[model samples]
Target: MPTYQCFDDLQLFFKENNIHPNIRFENMNENSIFSMVKHNLGISIIPEMIIPKGLESIKVIPLELEQTRTIGLAIRTPISPAVKKFTEIAENWCRFDKNIV
Candidate 1:
């Protein structure tokens, strides 16, 4: 997987779990990793939002883990209606994102 803080964390996970992948690739752009998987270059582990299309991959697997990242939206108290609406939409998108995985 391309190097990132998350990859460091994943390395720790693999070490702790005693799992290893024989072949790996590293790059700054996540799309590079995705492209590897998409073009039969390699397999990758990544978040769902990076996917270019829905239900288009050869296989899709979901993981139910003991932990998940928490997401939130914050606004100053006297926010305009438009901002509030935007936050609502964003919050809903967050929920949808979580459910898909």
Candidate 2:
């Protein structure tokens, strides 16, 4: 499992539901988590996008709860032209269709 903000959120979720899981690992990246799970080290809650296909040993189970993840772009000062354009495009895309959930 990760030792990030999402880890905290997952902990809160488990606590709220009274699910005392046996978490045997921590501070691992998504790929590391996948590897561990594939080797039967433990199960994990990872983002759907990061999951690779064609892994017969692993199962992709969708979470039943309604959840949303907010993503943002972080750039240092004195950004380049390409990065500025990309950010503009991303912002526009995010604002395009607010009603489509």
The regions of model 1 sitting more than 4 angstroms off are 55-58, 63-67, 74-83, 96-101
Measured by lDDT, the strongest candidate is 2
Q: To one decimal, what is the Cα RMSD in angstroms of model 2 from the true structure?
A: 4.1
- Residue 70 shift from truth in candidate 1, angstroms: 2.4
- Candidate 2: global Cα-lDDT? 0.76
Candidate lDDT scores, in order, read 0.66, 0.76
Total clashes, candidate 2?
0
| Per-residue lDDT of model 1, residues 1-101, tens digit only | 75864676667666867777774567779767766777888776665555567646535565444324445567898999999999988877776865533
Kindly give the number of clashing pairs for every candidate.
0, 0
In candidate 2, where is summed lDDT lowest over 10 consecutive residues? 92-101
